[model samples]
Target: MFRRARFAVLFGVIFLVILRYYTTTRHSILDVTEGKTSGPWREEWGHPIKTKQSKGANDTVHDESDEYVNYLRVLHRKHGFTNDVPVATRRIKAKYSKPPLKARPSLAQVKNPLFKDPLGFTRARLDSDNIWLPAHAEIPPLSLPIARTGPRPSSIDASSLLFGISTTYARLTYANNALLSDWAAWLTDGRGSSNGAGLVLTLHGATESQVKTIRDELHHLGIDVTLTASAEGETDAGGRYAQLVQQMMRQRHREPDRKWFALVDDDVFFPCMGRLLSRLQKFDTSETHYVGVPSERADWVIDHGTAITYGGAAIFMTAPMLDTSGQLLCLQYTKTSGQTGLADEEDPGVGMAWDEGLSECLARNTPDIKMDVLPGLFSPTTANAQTNIDDVQRGGGYASGALPLALHRYRNYHRFEAGKGHAVTSACGEDCFLQRFLFKDGWVLVNGYTLTRYDGGVTAEKVTVQTPKKKSGGADSKGAVKPSERLRIVDAEDVNPKERYALSWKGKKKTWRLLDARVKENGEVWQAYVNRRGGGNTVGGDMDDRRPGDIVHHAEEEKSDVDSVILLIWEGEGEK
Candidate 1:
């Protein structure tokens, strides 16, 4: 009995050791899609089994959890128990740990499976958010030669012209002095004159000293000088100013009798004054009221007017043109309001109002006057009090190709403290609003080679003010201002000769034949006609042969008489 009991104990020990070995060697199968694990077990007959469950229930029924636990126990027996085993109460909870979070898909990942990778996901995110990204590949460098088609014709004449200067102040230290001198010199040079013989200087609000200096300087150069001034504390400075100018003109007009009057501001400079003036002198004004300088701000409402706003500083007006309408033009421009201390703003509604009103008054009051335009003459110059002779030299005098004709120094007076300023520059601010308005009404402006610096005893920087657009409806439907519409014309005006010629062929055999025989109008090809018979049999030969008197189809292209046209003739043989 003792021997048998000992043998049974040895058998149980061996069995336990074998079971632990199998458990340690086996792996657990995890169901990633279901977010769970099948647990660990030993294979029996190619199937996993739980030692405890197999003994208690039918072996055919598999229990994953039971199998897992049994396998753990077997491993503990063979490899020694580890602290990693969970407590009995925590095992169940651990099996159902929070379900794995789902990943969010990107736009590209959703669109293409191949782009489902992380890199593609990043790109898709950036693209969907409208973020800029670097290109994936480097671009090859291009090597091409620039070819000139032909030489352009010169449209401007460089001699014998007149320029005008307009001003409200005539002080020596005013910022426009240097500018005016430069303009005078440029005009003299451009006109090929030894002296500024035709240059007319018109001054407004001239002090006694200022008038004396201007008259003396201009007199020495043989140039005409007209100084207009108002009495101290006058209520109507504009009217007085106008009267003074007229008086000066009458005095000069009665003398040598000048043919043209150049109206210029005291502070205007003329860098290219000579070239522009020379060009102006060559223009035929018999059909126009005035020939104006080219300007960026041109208005369309002024009749016979080209949009080229000139600086009130420098404009060229014919003596006859002004004599005919000068009084009425001055009358219409007369100030209706008392001087307001508001020097920082433009008084469009005050001192001087509608540009159209001024133009209309001139047109109605003077019936024989016409107008033309000069190109590229006037530009605003430095108007700051801090500008000096040195600054003018560094900035290039009015004669510099890029220099502006008119400079405004008025703002410097109000902005910065006096005495602390250096030299004055620019009279009309940077944009020169007044210059634009005048140019739009057909006025000639010139910036000569000389600098006309103003030392108006004030210092200030110009500021831009935005005007709110008026609403069309009530507050509820208010909207921002709409941009003006633009029209584009294309055809012979835009296309080249060779390209235009090829466009005449419409692909239809009949149309092609008609186009081949068409003649050109001016220098461009006119309309073409195509034969319209079903084939060639109805007209003459076989169906394949060309025919006449069938039906005629016209070419798509047509040209006006003023444009150039080409004549086309058929070269190959065809049935008549």
Candidate 2:
């Protein structure tokens, strides 16, 4: 009986020791897993825990939350703040508001086949998303020649151009700054005298101090600015144009030496101002010339059966044209109001849309003005079929040779400034795509299609490269081109290094040039339709055998090995 008792006591002792060791070891393992010994305490969501500073340490916790809020407040005061701030801030706060719930492995979930393997399930979902691409691929070798920055044309002077910008007080420091910088670059360049170039800011709802501030900002940009108020008490959106016209007339009277007066939107980007000035230099500034591309509203109310110059792409008027209109154009514009057409639904005389209103005034007042419909001088969106990118790609007998001049309604001030933020960049799909077209560096990829100039000059090759297209009904098939996608250009190193392609009209040569192949920003080569001076155009003859509306291709097709479908050429002294 004593032996049995001793054995039981020994077993009990062993059980106690094992239990103690298990408890201590389990705790140690958990501590190591949590990294509590070697690192600072972290929350469940991987954020550092906020700790109170102890009296022993000299260091104190510093919170810049207030400062950040104040900085945003100041930005709001100076420039309008972003619209998504409240929603974004609240969402972030909500995400870290409480501790993340530890997900327990439920038997119900385990039973479901879809959730049987967590890793596999996640992989499947990611595959379905189609957002992720393969990290590396065998991109075909491209041989694009590096473009040379040629000498600035001594014949062309940009300072002779007068720019009248239409903007509001709020946008001066924000959206307009980008354009102001470009203009400043041209003005600061010693090639053109500041006296030859001038800037006029037509502002609405700007105070005297605000105007002064804007003036100072322009002065800092190294250009003298003339600030003018929009016609007071005018309730029409078109009233701003009246104000600008009036201001331009006054300036025309004041500065007779300034040759070209261009009315561009505050966001209008003239990538090649020197080339533009050269084109303008060909025309007589003393003659009444109305130069711009035309736009028409689908509603057929205001600009019905008439081609009106889209103001955003920019409208240029020679001094003589402005002189001929005198004050009649301004008076007519002011008399028209946004509410004029709304009052009578039955006979809504042309609504006070700036483009339509300006068209009416010019047509009625200045009959002697020469209207130059250079569709290439404006953005492609100003055309009749605005949504059709194929119209541009096909280049069916339009001014296919002339590069696009300005991108209208392409505003992306959100990157630099604050506000609701224009979606121009987003709309273009990717940075590369935007840079290729809108922010062009004088080259465009022409794949499987030829573009002919208006004068029946250049014809492209007829060859197709087998490219992969997204399956008819897939996730990636729906959206525009994916971001950061690189497109390959075939044989883009075949242009004379010294000779530039120039656009010729009526025996006069302009600096505009077109090349067959050109290099893009990412060192990729493209069978490009390159023009030294970028602008839009409408061809007159059949660009290719293919009919219009049949040239639609998927954005992903850019990755395909397409042939040199574009035939671009330079029409000048040396290029053949």
lDDT of 1 by residue, 1-576 (tens): 999999999999999999987775311110110112111111121234333322222122234344333333333333222223221100000011123212100000011111111111111111121211112112111111111111011122222333334444434434324333333333332122333344434445567777677766555433444444454434243333344346545644454444454454443333333334444556444423454332211211111211123223233555555555455644423343433211113654343322223333455656454444332322111112122122233322211222222243312211111110110111111111111000111211111111111112111222322223433331112221221111111111110111100001222221111111111121111111112223211122232222232121123222111111111111111111
Query: Largest lDDT belongs to which candidate?
Result: 2
Off by over 4 Å in 1: 1-171, 175-184, 187-194, 198-210, 213-228, 233-241, 248-252, 255-257, 285-288, 294-313, 327-349, 353-360, 363-370, 377-576
Model 1 CA lDDT for position 215:
65
RMSD of each: 37.9, 23.6
Clashes within 3 Å, all models in order: 95, 22
| lDDT tens digits, residue span 235-255, model 2 | 455556555666788776777
Model 2 regions lying over 4 Å from their true place: 1-156, 175-179, 182-196, 231-235, 293-313, 329-351, 368-370, 377-402, 412-576
Model 1 TM-score on a 0 to 1 scale:
0.32
Clashes of 1: 95
Per-model TM-score on C-alpha atoms:
0.32, 0.42
Q: Evaluated with TM-score, which candidate comes out highest?
A: 2
What C-alpha lDDT, on a 0 to 100 scale, does residue 281 get in candidate 1? Answer: 55
Cα error of candidate 2 at position 184, Å: 3.7
